[model samples]
Target: MPRYKLTIEYDGTPYAGWQRQAGLPSVQGVVETAIARFCSAEVTITTAGRTDAGVHASAQTVHVDLERDWPADKVRDALNAHLSQAGEAVSVLTAERVAQDFDARFSALRRHYLYRILNRRSPAALDARRVWWVPRPLDAEKMHEAAQRLIGYHDFTTFRATQCQAKSPLRSLDVLDVTRHGEMIEIRASARSFLHNQIRSFAGSLAEVGFGRWTADDLQAALEARDRARCGMVAPPYGLYLIGVDYA
Candidate 1:
């Protein structure tokens, strides 16, 4: 079997999520179907992250094992063709052969996520599904200060979702930054791996700090509490984007 890695981008508004569901359309199902069409085999694709519904990806990665060898560009073009027939939102940006030992999920060294917030009185129209809209102005500097407290290794139980399946609550957060560009608030976060809904939880809590409801010390206390209830809120899914992935 030949192993291939795929880099993908998609507007996830119309799909149920990255993982395939029984009846709901998903990113995985669409790509797998495309691979099957080209490779003439039942291929199982493994992804770097299983993003939730309404979450977007600018650079999602996946790996598949094909029964026969095919040129990288051919595979990319073929998958895009099938995806185009299926819908316009999903695309296989690139594909290439990789080592047989390369597992998309496990081989990943770091994953970067960006959460976008449109801060203004007006409701979002052109990119409604791509960002979270907050009518009230946010203090991005305060949010950044609060986020710094979350850096380094710690028990992230407060930020982890109740339904999170990670075996342990301990994880190292490499970066957490908050910045504003006009009406757009951008949050950049990176870690080796994230628990389910962890980023959203972090963003929500920080947004509270940005709105003057929480402070940097409060965020520290929440982490020290190591309780999910101590967290601020779980931000909306529309704002989240899987922006980058680094492999070792």
Candidate 2:
């Protein structure tokens, strides 16, 4: 068998997240269906990250094993052709043959995410569903300053979803930066893994600082509390994106 790695991008607006469900549409289901159409095989693929519904991806990584060897470009173009024919908002950006020992999910070294916020009184004219719109003014600097408090290893119980299956809440977050670009506030996070909803949890709480509702000290207090009840909010999934993945 030959293994091929795929880099994918999708709108994530009309599907029920990355994992395949019994009947609901999913990124995995759509891609697998496209593969089946192209190769007529029942194949399974694993992703570096499984995003939630409405959570877009610009550079998601997945790997699949095929019994018959095929050209990487052919695999990419064929799956994309099938996906386009089906009107799916997904694309196979690139495909490369990899060693059998390479595992897309487990071999990942780092995962990066970006969350966008439209900060203005005016509603999103064309960027709706791609950003979180905050009508009030936000202090991006304050949000950035507050975000640093969450940089190192910590018990992120306050940020973890109640239903999170991660065995422990201890994880090291390598990067968390907030930057402003005109009307957009971008939150970038990088880590080997994240507790479910951790980034969104941070965004929701950081929004408080940006909105003048909470101070840096308050944000730090929430982290120290380590209680989910103390967490501020979970930002909407539409604004969150799995931006990239790194492998060694």
Candidate 3:
């Protein structure tokens, strides 16, 4: 068997999510179906992140195994062509042959996510599907100050979804920053792995700080209590993006 690594980018507005669902269209199902068409065989594709619905991916990575060898470029082109024909909301940016041992999910070292908030009274028109439109101004500096309290290894039960399947809530957050560029307020978070809905929950809570509804000490207490009910609201899925993944 031969293994191939694919770099993928997708506008996730129309799919259920990255994982394959029985009745719902998904990024993984679309890409796997395209690969099967190109290889003329059954193929299973595994991704580095299982992003939720309405969340975009700028540089998502996946690995697939085929029964026979095919040129990397041909694999990329054929998959893209099939995806276009299927009217799926994904594109294969590139594909390359790799060692058989290269597992996309297990080999990942770090994953970075960005959450975007459109700060204005009017709703977005051009990039509405890619951003969250908040009708009020957000104090990015205050959000940043509160986010600093969340860095380092800690139990993040307060920020995780109740249905999360992670064995543990202990994760070392390598980076957490809030910044503003023009009318967009962006939150960047990086870690080895994230619990289900962790980023969205964090964003929802931090937004309160930006709006003066919460304070830095409130965030500290939430983390200290390790209680889910202590955290702020969970932001909508549209604002989240899997920006990058690093491998060792």
Candidate 4:
């Protein structure tokens, strides 16, 4: 058996989510079906991160085991062919053979996420689906300052989804940065792993500060409250993206 590592990217707008469902479309379902069509065997894939519905990924990592060893390029090209023919929006960017000891989920050391906000008086035309459009003028500087309060180890129950299955709310957030370029505001977050809807939750809360509805100290108080009700409006999934995953 050969274990193959595959880096994939997808639009994620048309699919239900990363996980397979009985009747709904999903990134995992389409990828697995494409692989089965390519090799005539069922293969299960383990991904580094499971993105939610309408969430995109530029470099989502996954590993799949095959009964016969095939050339890595063949795997990538063949999977893409099947996926494209079916009109799927997913793409396998790269594939390579890896040691059997590697596990995509557990071996991951860091996960990076990005949130895009279109902050301007005029509405977004080209990036309506790719960004959160906020017509009101935002204070990007204040949003950045508020984001700084979320860095470091802390109990993140305030930002976690009610349905999050993570056993603990404690996580060490390595980075949470906010920056603006012209009319766009980008929020980048990095950590070993994230709770369900955590980044989206952060984006919404941060936007409050940008709207002058919340202050840096108020954001800090929300974190200290550790109550889900204290969390700001959870951002939509369309603007959230799984940007990258790191491994040693």
Runs off by more than 4 Å, candidate 2: none
Better of 1 and 2 by lDDT: 2
lDDT of 2 at 119: 94
How many steric overlaps does candidate 4 have?
Answer: 0
Of models 2 and 3, which has the larger lDDT? 2
Global CA lDDT computed for model 4: 0.94
lDDT per residue for candidate 4 within 1-248, as digits (tens), equals 89999999999899999999999999999999999999899989999999999999999999999988999999999999999999999999999999998999999999999999998888878987789888888898899888999999999999999999999999999999999999999999999999999999999999899989999999999999999999999998989889899989
Ten consecutive residues with minimal summed lDDT in candidate 3? 35-44
Per-candidate clash tally: 0, 0, 0, 0
Report how far off residue 155 is in candidate 1 (Å). Answer: 0.7
Instruction: Score every model by TM-score.
Output: 0.98, 0.99, 0.98, 0.98
Output the worst ten-in-a-row residue range by lDDT, candidate 2.
35-44
lDDT, candidate 3, 163-242, per-residue tens: 99999999999999999998999999999999999999999999999999989999899989999999898999999999
- Model 2 over residues 36-97: C-alpha lDDT tens digits? 88889899999998899999999999999988899999999999999999999999999999
lDDT of 1 by residue, 1-248 (tens): 89999999999999999999999999899899888888778888999999999999999999999888889999999999988987658888889999999999999999999999999999999979999999998999999989999999999999998988999999999999999999999999999999888899998999899999998999999999999999888999999999989997
Report each candidate's C-alpha RMSD, comma-separated, in the order given. 0.8, 0.7, 0.8, 0.8
TM-score for predicted model 3 compared with the true structure: 0.98
